[model samples]
Target: MSRGAQVGVATVYRRFPIKEALLTEAFAEERDRTLQLLLDLVRRAQEAGALRRDFVLEDVGLALMANAGIRAQSPEVRAEASRRFAA
Candidate 1:
């Protein structure tokens, strides 16, 4: 993974300490990116008078929290669940 990222394997191990830690951080970064995109979309929708003015980013955050259980499933199931959840 570090090689693909053009980073040294030793540096990756040193930063993450464990594989689980690396996975956790990667998941967090991905989640953050998703949330940012959602926020931007929400803002654009609101500006366009599509979404309700009362709708907020926290609502999306809460929904993501509720959907967090999908992480416990197998990768294939998780991917499908995520697709459905987003839909």
Candidate 2:
């Protein structure tokens, strides 16, 4: 799923106070799920020679963070940004 599709999930995370004790714990499950999926895709990309062997989980984190930072004037633009990020 694209980041745009995850807006609700993101909103849920944002709802908790920044310093909430259980916030990290709550987000961990979703984070792990997303990480595993990214790892799977990375492995395939490597096998297809589209990605280098040096890729790591941290790169996935960085990519997600970068995508999250994207802002647009409208829903259509935001959706486009998510598609571009996925690509």
The prediction achieving the highest TM-score against the true structure is 1
- Residue 37, candidate 1: how far off, in angstroms? 1.5
Which candidate's lDDT is highest?
1
Give the alpha carbon lDDT tens digit for every residue of 1-87 in model 2: 227546565565566546574468778999899878988998999999998789887887788888889899998998899889877
What lDDT does each candidate get?
A: 0.84, 0.80
How well is each residue in 1-87 modelled by candidate 1, as lDDT tens digits? 455788988889889999999999879988899888989999999999988889899888776886786774488888788889766
Candidate 1 ranges with C-alpha deviation above 4 Å? 1-11, 61-87
RMSD vs true structure, all candidates: 7.8, 11.8
> What TM-score number comes out for model 1?
0.49
Off by over 4 Å in 2: 1-19, 62-87
- Measured against the true structure, the TM-scores of the candidates, in listed sequence, are 0.49, 0.46
For residue 44, model 2's alpha carbon misses the true position, in angstroms, by 0.7
Query: What range of 10 consecutive residues in model 1 has the weakest lDDT sum?
Result: 64-73
